[model samples]
Target: MKLWDYDAFILDLDGTLIDSGKYHAQAFADAVLAQSGYRLKPYEHHEFFGKHSIWFAEDLNERYGLSLDPQEVLKHKRERVQEIFVAELFAGAQAFLEFWCGKKTMALATNSPLEFVEPALRDAQIFNCFDVITTASDVKRRKPDPEIIEITAERLDVEPEHTLVFEDQLIGIKAARAAGAKVIAVDNGQPVNYPVDVAVHTWNDLLKLSELHRWNPN
Candidate 1:
């Protein structure tokens, strides 16, 4: 559990590092309702949680008998979500990060596209904190696929086994675990069904672990 034992660190956005899932759900629901007069229910929001917006849009189109292009719908949804993000970070995320500055190499690996990531983190004033930042737009496959995690490890020159991931979504946890990293699952957003190495309900949980694990060297 030691920070120094890990070669690289990975984190998920939306839910893990930020409390923006509700905004995302609202945006998606609004977009679909406006475009096709279809309402995405709460269960549907849960189902779409960790996926790429394009896939979510396509799924909605197929489910509702609509002919909207996935890309166009996704673009609209993103614009709406951005309006809701508005220079915010998860409660306690920035202060927690301050304690670990320069202690480990960090990366942000999310299924969100670069368009959203760039603005969100920058607006939150944490764009420079990570050593690497990647999104679904940069990868051939998204979460539940190990390609992004593998690429992240490779780029950071970090062994997959020594990497630690802070993920919010079950699919993201699966993807990071599949890449051979140990994971800490954050529960600030919607709940999930994945088994995690550790479950953290708040930044305090992470901070507590950091103090206990810092000098242990794994």
Candidate 2:
């Protein structure tokens, strides 16, 4: 297949650029268990992988009658994630990003709070790759809201139509598309039922694409 060209880039943090999904998933499971004695199903891990912590908590509460306090659930999840999570970038993510750094102006737009994001990327040694960073704390809205993506584009001074986004979660994909950017769905063992421009299993798969498609001047 051919590439969809673009001038700027946006990436999702947890699953798209890093290998932190399992840790996050486990953290959610542990948090739920601790809060209400409920065990999250294996599929629940990725069901809301890219959403804000509060949203996940609300979903759990609404669906299971757990009455989980969003803040409390977030606290539990964060504590567990911090204690047991190993900060690691996905294989080839750093290499692929380094390759693209020379070619594109990239930004990070994740639902993760600023505190978690900065340290995670710093520890993973990929924090400096982005020209702009927009986390949950930076905006009033979260994924599927388009605020974060829109802000990232503005910070990069790139037009939304000229931007391309890498996302692994359906929520991220929805937000990227809502921001009017092309979406490349990164498969991180999660199922995305959205209509994205392209889907790949790893950053290397994109690196191997024949070419990245560029904007057409009419």
- Clash pairs for candidate 2: 3-213, 4-213, 5-213, 5-214
lDDT tens digits, residues 105-171, model 1? 8898988889888888887888888999988888998888988898888888888888988888878
C-alpha-based local distance difference test score of model 1: 0.78
Candidate 1 residue 131 Cα shift, in angstroms, is 1.1
Question: In model 1, which runs have C-alpha deviations exceeding 4 angstroms?
Answer: 61-68, 196-201, 213-218
Q: Write the per-residue lDDT of candidate 2 for residues 1-218, one digit (tens) a residue.
A: 13435778889898888888888889878988888998988778777566667788898888989878889888899889888878887776887787777677889999888888999999998887889999988999888889999999999988987898888887888898899888888865566675634565567677655233333322
Best by lDDT: 2
Candidate 2: how many backbone clashes? 4
